[model samples]
Target: MYHDYTEPTWSAQQLLLIALLLVPAVGALLVALLPATRSRLVAVSFAAVTFVLSVLPALIRPADFGWFAYTPLDSAPVPPWIDLDLPWVPALGLEFHLGVDGVSYPLIVLTGLLTLLCCAYTPAKGLAALLLVLEVGVLGTFLALDLILFFLFFEVVLLPMYAVIAGWGGPNRRAAARKFVLYTLAGSVLLLLGVLLVVTKAGTGDLVLLAASPPLDRTTQYTAFALLAVAFAVKAPLWPLHTWLPDAHTEAPTVGSVILAGVLLKMGTYGLIRVGLSVAPDGAAWASPVLGVLAVVAIIAGALICLRQTELKRLIAYSSVGHMGFVLLGIATLSVAGIQAALLGNVAHGLITGLLFFLAGTIKDRAGTGSLNQLSGLRETAPRLAALLGFAAIASLGLPGLAGFWGEAFAVIAAVDRGGPFWTTLAAVAAVGGALTAAYFLRLLRRVTHGPATPEVRSVRPAITATEWLAWSPLILLTLAVGIAPALVLSDTALPLATLLGIQP
Candidate 1:
């Protein structure tokens, strides 16, 4: 039943996903073609339109929704909601397909929401066009179900992002962009090889089919999974894989950092859950313990480093390492609760950490330096900004009232339930990691938000913009809403989660 829902059958809403891809592409191209000297309003408006138009499919009733896109040439018409197919090439047994069900719906929505936010917050006309094109790439990556196609969309996300950071970033932009691309390129190469191995082994590259009847023998699967895992692990920035991130975050322009932390990183964990767990459960089970230990190390190590950091952007960057550690913990558990917790963490981290970067960028944009020692009286000078930072920070510390809490709460609980010698030993370590997170963030809050006025205040005050608040409030609101009701995500995702975990439908 879950496989039936996800196959490449073209439904009406599924076609909307295609439109979601095309509309932004067209609009962004137009923006790019426009003269750079023109008012940036045109670029911003075009970007905004994509966000407004995205609601078309999201509003569809569950009953009306099915997944796929088709063309008249060799396939059926793309449905308004779904698309499915078993393609030709019997010799190879491969199918070209695409679809989305409830599990992927949140990411689809998040990509749309963050793209819109990116559109709203972007300042440069040239860059606005690039950002819109980037949004299309992201949306495509989320919706694609074909392995080869998915790889293409995944690669598409990188170029625009590379351009955005290098073209518009601070003084260190070139180095950051290079580092970001090098890491992602290395990951993408591994993903490509993994995709090739699966196709070569199983004679099909359709994600739906692969998930339904996975490719590769146990040895081959283990090898293929290592390639895929390391590829995604880099993107997930798990512990040692995370070094590229802090530099990227510190140097990236506001919107670049926003999208990077918000949507791009989740792509990795999403792939791990969707493709890795579903298609290579045995390998995933094999890798689970190692992932657990690393999770604890990342949580603890990231927190420890943050305690030593004086740079505000770098501190927030390290906090991401800690927060994402919870995400890893959830993935490592190999339980439904753990998977769900990882998903929860994905969404929460996007909201909370992305918000932190946004507000941190605002402060840095004002104060001339992101160094914590140079900052003081932020609350007095830019109270709204201080407030946004506080909300994002406390949430990062997993305060119960916000979105960040549930992923950790669920992960720790799941770890305990997945108990035994190693799991329990490591989970206890993760629990201690939690305390470290709280300790450092609280210290950061005091030093940044609760200090006497300094020369920075006069500078920070004048730069506060209404536009920043407008862009930030929605994320903060979602953080609060999801904290109160995580079921919105978990419920919709249950069937897909069950399928991935090999639970009976």
Candidate 2:
């Protein structure tokens, strides 16, 4: 069910949604055309406005007759707080349909905030412009309710990100960018096929309608889910499909990595919940066991890989695999608790990992190396940077009373809640993986911040920049805020998850 805003045709909410997409988009073009010196100001201003707009949807209370009001148990599964539907391609049976709800609103806000930070932090006009363009793609992906529109927005992110990596990255960036594009393009092909399959079979491309009452048969659902799952898994970069990630992270620039880890990867998990399970319940159930097994494998494998990594960025990159594994595990459970954990985990990972990448980039820039062994006793030289790194690492390790704890700890709990021999065992192994996460992070802290200061550390500047503080402070604060009160992300999610899982709210 959608909110039937009783306001006039061009309502405030409608314009707000339009501005959310349009502002950054126009900003990108303006930033590109403007003088190099003014680009940062223009980009940040657009991103700031976009971020502010992103939050308003959550505050707009539904009317008495809206979806949020008391309704029967058979309410629409994919209800949006605000939705806009307009004709696009009649020949393709596609409409320009977009909506937002608890499931996507958090991610939208996250994308906006991170992009704003990245734009502010980057000095290059081209990079800042690309970040804004990337923001538009990500926000559009979260907001799109039409299958074709979703796919279009999904593809829009690819080239700009490719340019970011290849244009401003470490050595061997070309190979990494090529791999990233080729790998994700393969997934995109699969995604297009899946979307077309669903549309052809169901004769419509509207996700809200399909999710509310799936028109596909069991076999169709199975095929659709399989295609969609692999496609999203590649983006999620689940386990073996994740080969592209560490390379991308290691080679990409600071802002690129932040966006890539922060909210870009989220498109996968969000798609899994929104498209995979919703469109094919039976297929998801059929595939749950396999998904569960792979998720646990990713958890253990990613953690174990992180322990052996020598480069700081590479280590942090691999850790995302492990963290995302927990998210996939939660989704595999297909319970209300499991999905909610996934959502919370998604937001948590974005905040904590984005900060980690930012800190890592700063440290590497100051010390002139990201090698864990070569860099030691950072606290002796750059206490502020080291302290921030320590905080981010601790948070990434899932320390309680921080943002990272809820998603990971509860993924295990949700698995236990799932309660079968296989699930129980998977839960146990995932718990072990969590232990490994802590071990590696402790090792990282010990290696980088605890020992005697090296020559590189000695030469490093101790002061933290105002720009760095402006970029990182929100992530640090939000990590604690969401950790202390999980409700910040989970508040609007319950009804949506319950509805998606076919459980009573």
Candidate 3:
């Protein structure tokens, strides 16, 4: 028997998800209203709440649903589980859309954890509000379902990060901050143009819609991809375009560097997958070989740069370039395995590199300098610190049974399995770069942690602080956990990626 039925106006679960997404922004506002002395506590509480909320969706196993609907040229109703799709500036065809899927949920959790950790670890007064604000942007970027909404969230990250660098960083902070803004803003312009072209051409800004039915023809897809690639590349800070990173890492405060390495850079790689490949598949295929070559070069070049780097933070920054290269290489292969590797690499790099920067900052703060040559014999004077540094160093160098290994190994494996002359060559070069990565990190270990105590090291006092330990333990434990069971990240990513790639899960 058939019966008339109506869907509830909105499910409680959907409303809860929307509440989770907005929690940080509301918290940021509340934080701003609080007394300066209480800001940290308020920010932490709200961040913790947001983190809890972010985790809820995973537990409940929500299905896809729509928030609000709109008329389109194609006249198809939007998909479900969109959560919020209210029309905004209907004349421009923009909507305030936000939602999540397997691809984005892990990143949302990463963003929440990193931001909370940064807030807990940072000693700078009057900054918790900004960090909370930044957290909102990072989470929103991952969850945003509309192109315009995504861009807004993406741009929201730029300003707070700039403030963090300029206000809390070291001697060269202002210059580093300016360079960061200029490079990113230039990229943002291109990103906006690309988004506009796609939305205008497709007559919709809905990412799900665009993915289901590419809005543009092949030639237009190619053009859109080119513009979008340039934008994301600058943010990924790919080789030749990567000049802004080392200085930013070196000059920014420890928390800033941690966030930069841990989550912000992921935005670029995520964009490449979410927007570039999905929206412009033909263009991505055409560009894959060239991108693979560039990824290989970035791998080698970043390692080479690390070999010459003397500053601890700069070395870690350069290391990020190489690690992210593995991610880009995996993406370039355009296979299920390659993309999965890229996803794994993305999370692993965030965890390992974040830990590395934190340790580097701790060492520098205690020793009063970051110069590897001048800072020696940490093993003798600061055994605990040296031991932690050694642990982080090995993990970052892709030691077996560490978080870094699975991603780097799988990226190379995927390239080999891709079975083309270009991919084969790229795989070989990347493997060699992996060796170079180990060498440079070993060199860093020898120069900074293994020698006789330097005068600075001998005079240093204070072990790792409670806040530092609290902030670090998660990354350290997660590194080992993921190392031992890469399936934690891989399993969640596999089906979503297969969907993205039009392959069977």
Candidate 4:
């Protein structure tokens, strides 16, 4: 929110936010125009170039590095302390208002980072376009201030993701994509309805205005909450709503899985915070218990499923359910620590789960399958790969010095801080989820990392290529950086977190 000029200077939001759309738009066209024979080159170049371009905004207008204390005792500004507005649709009372605050910035940076990483690791020629398109939608969703614009970005995820999964996924992909779409679509319909209801009741859909002055009666709020929550919940893939994930993750190609885990899943959690909490505080408070119970179920059930899965991709996919359960639990707490944990968890899952999928894909490439029973003794032929996998696993299992720990640890600690029978018990369940996470990772390790080589395991290949390392190293380094210095992240998030969570210090 630090801008030298109020109106004279070119806005970073103007340059950076608009660039997100333009790059992908142009990149997609360029990719399509390239000779088919250089299709691989085109895909790689488009991704690589687009990634470099993504950093321009950050380099040009570096994010302000400061913390917003959450207590009432400290003075902190509510975010977008600097704001930008451009008229796009006047009838709707909407403008292209873009600005950075504690909440949006990290999510924005994470989306940009992962999109670039995705472009790096993403290989499918036909599907890369959709991924780029998905990036546009996600980036827009995070930056958008209009309620309808936000919803558009939210639903933009539907088609491109469906196309990616259906076009590039495994044998059963069509069905998996269909199931994924049907659920999300039903949810989107409800989301649209809630949007209309809010706009009708509140007289405006501008998120800034809505957040400034949310309307609707308590009854209407709860009704809208249920509808919108169901819609976002489908995305959150919470408990019963999560049936589509394992199949989607299992069937999706590596990069597809990566984006799915890395960014798409966070959309659900993001909506919970952005739309659910921000627009429907009363409803959110009312439904917190429902979210809380479902989170507990997901934590316990997802962990148990991970323990049983024999396929590496499926295991990681299920682990997402558990990881995201903590995200929901954090949101449910309705406290700054809880919300911060959820935000932290969002970034952590993107790093850790993305790495796990990437490594799993590498193992599958060398070994010809992702089935654990068919592979063993990765240490013998691919010791370095084994080490990377170990690193990702233990980190995901919530090892203290790693990125994954904070999300889960903070969620549980925040829940404990909330100190209710429900919160305390769910905290205990999430802790068990944590322990079970460690158990399964350890189990996967025992099964795949060491001991005498089975025929399938012994056939493991050499170290990852330079390209692969480049694709993965950022995520690896980020995991360590965030884990070691979460304050760096937390500092960036403080104001937005305080504003959204209604904390003022």
Candidate 5:
């Protein structure tokens, strides 16, 4: 092993990037050791640093024609912004590889932003440290280039999120946490097995190598893809697997719900595109129809569930299932347009749903409830809050001028343009689901914000806190910005996605 292994070299930039990755974990440790009173300040300070590091790569990496394109060299599919390649286990051919590209850069920035916002919005409680820890996992998952490394980062997200829910959540937090653990654990088992299968067959755990020169044969790819699908779907929480999401979101504290929807759930769909499809195209193509069908069902089913929900938080939670459905449908198409749509949808949902959760939490805190039935006449009692909520709802419903529209519109276009009987049918069904989404949101708005104020609402003053405004403004502005100029995201993603899927560049 020693004879074959060579010590890896790192440049200053690579070392600095690695340091940035370690900052959150190091900060978490420091925060954990500090007095609880000072933890929030320290966490936020560290989060700000981490956020700067996250955005640095985009500036450092040159882009041509608005797309972050890289010529593959030494068999690397796309030149990672800062590839840290070093042998970890020579016998197994595993390396301590980390990097980021167009596909992951946006999400890394998102993780940083959301983490900072979470810290800012909440009191200087013990929760800030945990959020930082979760950030480490989320960012690492986006950056990891080794399959084993990716899996480790992916699992790191579980404990902190569970703690957040169980420790800070509402009445049903315990049960929700348990359900979340059970589902994710079950999914992880399958995912772990899949990783093993791929690595064993490929004889290496490096994601870059696996994609550049697929080592697994078609049969093995199919088996691994199937296993990975179950795991990712559970996290994506598609339709039947999505039961845990509503409970977790409804019970979780505001920041918990925001991060869960904004950053955590995207992990699953992102994994599908990055690992599932890139590593196993044949399997993905074979499974696309099934995936597409479930996606459409999730869209329709999630909307249908929301329509009947009496609780505001739970309804919004259910709405995520529907919103994520569009992301999944886009991935199933396996076309460049489809994957780009998925990526755009991911960011849009993060902005839209995160804002919704933040607002919902504010309403609950102010009026002492999250029940739509009791949340009447917000427009009359709290016009500003109602306006914000209304705008977020419209964005979520895929209004023409909102960020949500591009994702849904492109997903349908990808499906229809794929031009098979099955895909065309998926597009039609999803179009129907889009209408249902509008219906539920309209119903939600009419019930919660437009009606006459109830006695309870009248008693409580729904003043928007400075913290709420501070935390929500970025999300609100981004939703509008992305809506007006989707090219901000799409341009960067196009070449990379096409490269990943073997589409024409």
Candidate 6:
């Protein structure tokens, strides 16, 4: 179990949490009501404020108590840095609970930053408002401490994303949007069932309480974890459930793809840690082998498939399946090192993959085609773009000093730490998958960045735009920063993960 830092009275911390959700919510409305001409400025302003506010929570010190302060007899597992709880639908056993800690703070900031960048980059008239609305859902999902509230926030992202894709996406927008919705809705149904089961059985929707003392029996815990895991896997789009992602990325607009790949997919991995494992440790233990196996499968399958992909966006989309497989693998280890690596992997994937989509979108837009065969010799025309793409690809392939390396490398280390034949085999196979990851990315760079300039490449603009630099620079810098110093994401995570997993500090 963890400790709680709940306060009886409202404070500046509480106000900031409320504002994180409200600013986006209010901004969505204002963007709709205000002139479209001013929408970009207004949306960016709100997103910027929210991003700034999200960072403030991290500066608020965690309670002075250390992880070693607790004993095995104690029941405090994961503690919030700051939390606010109020009665909401008491009859339904729900509360208006909100909180943030080491685990959630990084993701909240990532969501805010990506939303701000997307808003700044997109010029579509009404899309800015929709992006804000999506921000509200994602930010709320990361903030909510109530299970029911989390579900509501999670659902909130569905429609706005559908609208973004269907309204502003490419030629087959409607079809891609339909598939995305259908697959996720199916996952949501399972997610809802799991939430209702846990709440009804435990008689409370407060996640902190549930994490501290899971009330379900072994059987019920197994059932709940299974439902939640499968539901999140759909969002994580693990392996076979990942088919929708390629099409969605292939058709959605650039900003839409950025948000989708950047922060939205994180909801699944976050839920697995916060809800599935925290609320049902026995079940997580029971299912780790299966989870580990499947994650390995996803890693191998996604890489092999990417090797065969022809379209640029579709290949990047498939790569997510493999990257997220590392995350899921880390979670399956259920060690402090594994979970910490999972969190770092989550943030790194967001930065690197988000940049990849941005560059791919720009290339597709300028070249008038996304086909790898028709796109070549990018360095001859767009040297800067090619260089950035090369950096992103290398980072995605887990280059030693970059953001992507630590999470994946540590995930394997954590598995080795687990020290069993089964996990050892999974680690070996996953290592092979890593090698395959490098192969496909190098193949991608060769096809898209090297070789002689094609007709499409010759016609493309060589200069990078101010908006592109504005949006991509931060990701570039952060990817390098996090890669060089992973402690940026991992510093606050140890205590929470240790307590949550019952591992001694």
CA-lDDT, candidates in order? 0.77, 0.90, 0.83, 0.79, 0.86, 0.90
TM-score (all chains, Cα) for each model: 0.91, 0.97, 0.93, 0.93, 0.95, 0.96
Residue-level lDDT tens digits of model 6 in 1-505: 4443454433877888899999988988998998888988999999899899888886764545332332223545556777878899877667899998788989998999999999999877589999999999998999998999999999999999999999999999999999999999999999999999988888887888777678889999999999999999999888779989999999999999999999989999999998898788999999999999998999999999999999999999999999999999999998989998899999999999999999999999999999999999999999999999999999999999999999999998888888989999999999999999999999999999999999999999999989999999999999999999888887667777765665675
RMSD of each: 4.8, 1.7, 4.5, 2.8, 3.3, 2.1
Candidate with best TM-score: 2
| Per-residue accuracy of model 5 over 52-87 as CA lDDT, tens digit each | 888787665533223544444333355555567888
Global CA lDDT computed for model 6: 0.90
- Candidate 6, residue 177: how far the Cα is off, in Å: 0.4
Q: What is candidate 2's lDDT per residue for 267-337, written digit by digit as tens?
A: 99999998898788888999999999999999999999999999999999999999999999999999888
The lDDT-based order of candidates, best leading, equals 2, 6, 5, 3, 4, 1
Model 1 misplaced stretches (Cα beyond 4 Å): 1-11, 36-43, 52-58, 61-81, 84-96, 462-464
lDDT of 3 at 416: 97
lDDT per residue (tens digit) for residues 302-381 in model 3? 99999999999999999999998999999999888888788888899889899999899988888899998778988888
